[model samples]
Structures are given as C-alpha cells and as structure tokens.
Target: MNGLSRLPRLYVDPTLVPTAQKGAPCLLTPEQARYLGTVLRKKVGEQVRVFHAGMGEWLASIAEIRKDRGGLVLERPLRAPQPCPPLPLAFALLKRDATDLVLRMGTELGVSEFLPLVTERTNTHRINPERLHAIAVEAAEQCERLDIPTIAQVQTLPALLGNWPHQTSLFAAIERLDKRENTLHLPTRQVQEGDGLLIGPEGGLSDNECQTLLKRPFVVPVSLGSLVLRADTAVVAGLALLGNGLRSAPVSSQ
Candidate 1:
C-alpha cells in the first residue's frame, strides 16, 4: 500500500468488479486490459486503485495483464462509498464536440446529473449515451470524484420542466430579458443540495421558450452578465457561479 497512491485509477462497474474484500480477484474489461497492459505498460503485481459509485475505491495489485484481459487482487479500501449530490445540470443539446466538452467539464465541476434539453433552437436532439457515459467516467477518473454523474436521455425543455422535482429550484440562464419584465438575477441565491442549473443552446432559447420557463414557479431566471457565452462555455461559467451554494463538503481520501 505504500506506492498505491501513485497507481493509476480505473472506474469499474460494480456488477463486474465482484466483492470488495481483501485478496479478492477482480476482473477488468478488455479496454481496461489494453489500457493497463499496452497503454500504461503495467505488469503483474503492480498496484492500482479501482473505484465505482456504490463500492467506493480499493487498492489492488495487478494479478495478470494480457492483451485482451486482466485481473487485480484487492488489497484494501482507500475511500468510502459516497453517492454524487443531486446538483443536476440541464443544458440544450449542442453539436458533438461542444456536447462532449459540456459532459467532461460538467463532471469535473461536480455536476451529479446531466439533463440534455431539446429547446426550440437546438440543432440536434440525438445523444450517444454510451459515448457520453465513457467521457464522464474518464473525467471522473481524472478529477478524483468518488461517483460518476448520470446522463439523462434527451428531452424537450417543457418535458424537463414538467418532470422536475418541486423541492429543488432550477436556475435557468436566460439572457437579455427586459429588466421591467424580469426581476430574477443570475444564481438568484446559493445553490442548495438538490438545486440545479440550466443553460440554453448556442443561440439561446426562443422567446416562447423563455416565456414558458419564466412561467414556471420552480424555474429561477438568471442572467450571466452582459457577455453571451457559447453553450459549453456557459455550462462551465454557470456551474462555477452556482457551486458556492453547494452544501456538501468534499470527501477526503486516506
């Protein structure tokens, strides 16, 4: 365990990772095998940290490394299991690269769930769930997050608002509102545990969409200042603004 802190970390599916007890052998995915063997040149007996949402993180020693498969022997626990907070981020679906950036950065920024909204001005409604989940897992692995963020299926703006929970307020960033008609400021208040942030598409939500959002009691209209930002950029900026309100403290690893 002396050098375990320096080992590469991998996010493993709980169902596939087996038990968490010491000396238990855990199986690795083919991609992980390639990554450890070919990519990182990891060999037998080298230690690594494997973690997941429900199982927390464990130190393990590489049992074997082959071209298409690998296994690790569990050594001990590093961090206790903790679920991600319900700080959901609802953003209008953008192009491929931008959407990927949103997923990666949003995960790094402590977003627990991603709500992809299809607004009136959205260019596309399709999302590759598998690809996005992979990006999130990779980002979580790099960011040292204990849990991965969940990505919701693509839905319309109205649909998202309809299914939204009543207890949590949804902070929506809608720019250039008539000062007379709009009174809500950006991040009106600090974000609570279950509160969320919503960013519109590149061109911003349509007039009708803005009206629809403003009408909702749970939706808090927000302004991101004078400068308009790209959809991806807005996601980062909006999360940064609202992060201060989060009540959960960061989990320290031993």
Candidate 2:
C-alpha cells in the first residue's frame, strides 16, 4: 500500500482536481482529469491526495479517467478537516502590476483572506478575485499548502474596521518616533492563531486612516523598517514577516 503523498500539483487549470470529499468518492473535472490521466500519464489505482479550502485533507485513488471527468474511489479518511486559523490582509489598492505582485506574494505568505481597500491616495480598487484565486492556487500548489487562500471582496479601510469582530488587527507602520526607534515586529504563531495584518498603499495610509486604526480596539500599529516602501514592496515585505517559512526578517526587535 503506497501511503498517500501529494501529487496534485496543478500547473494548469483543466488538470486541477475538484475538492475531494472525506470518505466519499469524487470526480475530477474534465480539464484536471485529462491532465492527470492523459497529459501527466496517471492511470487507475494511482494514489493521490487532494485538498479543499480548509476542509482538512482528502485521500483518494484514481478509479477511472475519461475524456471528460475522472473518477476517484475515495478511501477511509486520512486526516480530520482542519480550518485555517484567522489571517487577513486589509491592503490598499495600487497600480495593476503592483497589485498583482502583492496579491501573488500575499497568497504564498499565507493570508487567509484579502480585503482590498481604496484609500484617499489609492488609484483603484479593481480587484480581480478570479485572477487572484488562480494565483493563490498556483502558490498553494507549489508550496504544498493543504488549501487555497480566499480573496475577500474589496472594502474600504473604515468599512473593514467598522464591522471588525474577531482577529488581532495589525497596522503596518514604521513612521512613528517610537516605532521608528524599533517597536516593529511580525506575528508569532501563538500570537497570530487568530489575527490579521494591514498594509497601506504605495503612498501609505492617510492621517485619517492611521488615526482610525489607532482607535480600533484590535488594531496594533507595526513598522516594517526605516525606509518607506512601495505598495507592492510593503505588501511582500510586510506579509513575509506576518507569515512564516519565507525569507528572514530584515532586523530583530530591541
């Protein structure tokens, strides 16, 4: 018996498997089936594991591969469904290229959800959820993450803070005197089992936005570093600190 190891590295969409259910047989969509069965040369009885969004994980075996959908004869459950711990990014929108970069990096850095905001200085809040989801899927596939991150609908900074109920909120800031002196730190696993991080636009959050966050109960102002960074740069840099298994932090806290 070959123990189930992940082989659902979906390099293409059509080959992506449907979210496998626990202890219940499921079929891979046409595109995914063709890729696995035809393109990748996988066949009946092959063992593979597939993941759904925080539905724990699924164990399945290839039962049939056809021109359309592929069938999987699911076996006994391998692991209990694990929900993603709270992780959110309230980020301001930027230019097309910059936003895309932030979205991609943020996904790999393990942001459970994204809230795109249009601040005073932001260019647009034109978020492409589908494209972002695709980016996240690719990132998750490459990183061997058990699930794909969710891209929340775009919302304003004030709006997001208004309805805030859960999560430890973090404001990415390296500007205040004390903060510049080095009070900035990233989220620890234990500290962030249920927390969220905020990244401003390229121009940074406006004074009003900053003040609003400061007043919020859950928000904690944080700093990235000495130099001001571009929107995309801050996103990648900030998320790198907030999420784990990425490059090391630029500096240690005092």
Candidate 3:
C-alpha cells in the first residue's frame, strides 16, 4: 500500500466520480487508458492514483484495461479536497511556447487561476484554452498539486483593470523605473492570499498602457530589478517573490 504513492497519478473529472470509496469503479478517459496500457505497460491489478480538484485524490488499482478504455477500483482515499484561495496571475499573452511555459511553471508555483491579457504590444489575442489547460494539468500532476489552475478567456488590459475587484491587490511588474519612482520597487511586505501578480509581454507595456495601470488604485507597480527579463522569465521571478511572501507570512495574516 505504501508503494501505491509511487504510481502514476491522473486527474479525473469530479463529475465522473460523485461517490468514492473502496472498490468503487472509476472510469478512465480513452487517452488515459491508452497511456497506461500502451505507454506505461501497466496491467490489471496495478496501482495508480486518481485525483480531482473538487473530489480529492485516491489510490486505486487497474480493474480493466484495453486499447482505448479502462477502469480503476478505488483502494482508499489518499487526500481530502482542500481548495485554496485564488492565486491569480494575469499576464500578457506571449508566443505559443512562452505562454505554455508560463502556464506550466505558474501551476508548479501554486497559481490557482490564470488571466491572459491582451495589451497594446501583445503579439496576439488568441489562445487554445484546451491545450493550455492540459499543460497546466500536467504541471499540477508532476508537481503533486491537489488542484489545477483555471485559464480564463483572453481579455484586454484596460478591461481587466477596470473590472478588477477592489479588495485584491494586483502587483504589476513595471520595468525601467526612474530613481525618483523608487517607491514603485517590489514591496518587502508579505502579500495577501487574494493578491495577484501581472506581467507584460515582451517589449513591455506601452506608455499609455503603463499610465492606465498606474491610475488604478488596485494596481501596485513593482520593479523586477534593473535588468530587463524575458516575458516568461518575469512571470516566474515575480511569482517566486510573491509566493515567498505568502509562505513566510503568518497563516492568520494571509
């Protein structure tokens, strides 16, 4: 039973298993079934962990496996569902590969929601939500996360700022700040749970876009240091700094 933890974990839809208990049948998607049977060569009675964002995780054994379909029998519960507050990371959409990287790494860093923004300089306003969602799911599984992040539909920069909730602080990473504007440097204090981090696309936000963000009371401009970083790099660095703050702060404060 201890070795069951080492088995591959798959994210199952919560709706697929409304009730979970020992010996309950858990169906697998065609892709998951094929991956287990063909790729991993796992046979009936072999163990695997199945999880869901709202239903928690369970250790189960392969009940049956064929070319395109399979099922599992739950052995026991591994963890109970415990959802966290939104860890929103709103970033300008970059190239396909960069955007995928941001979603993957962002999931690993505990981001619970992703808001893709289209700014004046953003290369494109389009994205395949299905593909991006899969990337985040894989990252969550690899990182042993209990939940997957939700990828919001693409939205414009001004629209996001205008509609953002007033209670949540959005840390905007602004580059090339003047010495007198040093107050805009990243804050040293711990960030609250609902707080979010925003990253601009490569070439950074335009002058007009920057001014718009500055005017928003919810937007707090922060410097990611003097050296200019690639868009994807900035997302990772900013999240790391903010995540550190969240981890260090007292639980009651968060």
lDDT of each: 0.87, 0.66, 0.87
**Top of the candidates by TM-score:** 3
State in Å the error of residue 45, model 2: 3.1
RMSD of each: 3.6, 6.3, 2.2
lDDT of 3 by residue, 1-254 (tens): 47765899999877667578888888999999999999999999999998887768899899999999999998898889866567899999999999999999999998989999999899888999999999998998888788989999999987888778999899989887655343545444458898999999999998777777777777788778999999999999999988887888787733
How do these models rank on TM-score, best leading? 3, 1, 2
Model 3 superposed RMSD (Cα) = 2.2
What are the models' TM-scores? 0.92, 0.74, 0.94
Task: Name every residue pair that clashes in candidate 2.
Answer: 14-31, 14-32, 15-32, 56-81, 56-82, 173-222, 173-223
The C-alpha stretches of model 1 lying farther than 4 A from their native spots are 1-3, 178-189, 247-254
Q: Per-residue lDDT tens digits of candidate 2, residues 78-125?
A: 556564556778788888777777767876677788888878888886
lDDT of 1 by residue, 104-152 (tens): 9999999999999888889898999999999999999998888999999
Query: Where's the lowest-lDDT run of ten residues in candidate 3?
Result: 180-189
Question: lDDT, candidate 1, residue 139?
Answer: 98
- Kindly report which residue pairs in candidate 1 clash with one another: none
